[model samples]
Target: MSLRAARDDDMAWLRRHYHQRRAAEFAPLGWPAAALDAFLDQQFALQHQHYTRYYADAQFLIVERDAAPIGRLYLLRRAPEHLLVDIGLDANQRGQGLGAALIAAAQDDAAASGRGLRLHVEHGNDAARRLYQRLGFEHEENLPTHAAMRWRAREPVATD
Candidate 1:
């Protein structure tokens, strides 16, 4: 249960992870294997380009457990706030509190710096939305495809 910097060799695993993430949405379309592969490839490429261009300085990390890659966490540290660009786990790794642990770590980092943590989750992603809410992330804005959410560190209480 640790994270390491992503490397060139991780492209293949990343691609597979991307495909897995979107496969369920497209699965019902009943497209041919070739067509589905092509579509996913193109979509993955586009997403890669978008993240690369916009989050050039972001930390692209590979989440691992027992030396095996199981997830990814992309983060961008900026003034007054930090962005949780993306976080995904292998399908098999879901629902075991791993995501919560990862986000908790990010929260700690932001709190230590006195910065708020922010992220966006797709409207259709109810599970993610619930998790964020449970972690104290409040809805800040609505976008066409996603909802912006933010979490601020709780201030310390003064005692006599």
Candidate 2:
């Protein structure tokens, strides 16, 4: 697996991925499939605009395997901290070790820089929350829609 800068061609795939993940959350509501699709499209557009406006400097990356796009990772590097804006994998790519590896890499980067790594996970996303927790991230704040989490750099143990 590798990451590359997202290109214009990747927007469609990204939007589709966003819709698939979000639609599942809304599935229980029993909205008509067509109506749900339209709603998700609008929401995705709003979210894309929000992220672009607020995180213009963040690295918007496309995660690839064997030259095929499989996911995305958005990261913002800031002094004393790094923000994991978003990470998602295609349905077929889920349940693999890729997400863990990516998070581990981010943790290593944070440790090397003496910085904390942070992210927000939707309150309903138990899987992601559990993963973050297992990887040492602790909930820092509870937002109306999501929970903010952070992982602090570990202190080095002195070998006497």
Task: Highest lDDT: give the candidate number.
Answer: 1
* Superposed Cα deviation of residue 125, candidate 2 (Å): 1.4
Q: Residue by residue across 72-116, what tens digits does model 2's lDDT show? A: 999988877999999999889988989989988988887899998
lDDT, candidate 1, 1-160, per-residue tens = 9999999999999999999999889989999988998899899899988999999999999999999999999999987899999999999999999999999999999999989999999999999999999999999999999999999999988999
Q: lDDT of candidate 1 vs native?
A: 0.95
Model 1 superposed RMSD (Cα): 0.9
Model 1 regions lying over 4 Å from their true place:
none
Cα-based lDDT at residue 40, candidate 2: 94
Poorest stretch of ten by lDDT in candidate 1: 33-42
